[model samples]
Target: MWGKSTAAVFLGMPLSVLVVGFAALLSHDQASTTLPWLLLFFLVWIAVMTCTFLFRTGLRAWLWMGGLTIAGYAALHFLKASGLVRIAA
Candidate 1:
């Protein structure tokens, strides 16, 4: 019961958002290429990451970071699949 507690789910959410947003913003630039959605996403993610930190739970933090890594991989897969990104394959 403790391992899958509401706290872990809640705590992981923010960190995931923050990390995803960071990836989005870092992936693109140029005023015209800039997207409001991306910016919003970034801010939301930062907020989430902040909240996770506030929880100060070591297990939650570790899980959050793990989820973040998975999310990053998923994003990369999407980008590659869409042909928006190339990995020299």
Candidate 2:
């Protein structure tokens, strides 16, 4: 119970953030399209939370989640820096 909650906080949240950030970046050109993207991200968050239980151990879950979140952020950063994706102000 506590472990699942911990995973939701430390893993699920960041994973959702990464997904939302990428979606936002991809849809930056069409700001009005954000609503659907946000909806999709919410579904993704639910899926991520459910999937966390598949790991055999809490530590493994945290490690993989943290690592993937970091990698996703890094990729987003690279894409933005390279101007492959433009963020609207």
What are the TM-scores, per candidate, against the unseen true structure?
0.38, 0.79
Residue 66 of model 1 has an lDDT of 66
Kindly report which residue stretches of model 1 are placed more than 4 angstroms away from their true locations once superposed: 1-34, 54-56, 82-89
Clashing residue pairs, backbone N/CA/C < 3 A, model 1: 14-48, 17-45, 18-45
Write down the TM-score for model 1. Answer: 0.38
| Pairs with steric clashes in candidate 2 | none
Per-candidate clashes come to 3, 0
Question: Model 1: per-residue lDDT, tens digit, 1-89?
Answer: 34434444554565555455545445545333336545566466556555555545657665766666678768766876887764321
RMSD of each: 7.7, 2.2
Top candidate on lDDT is 2
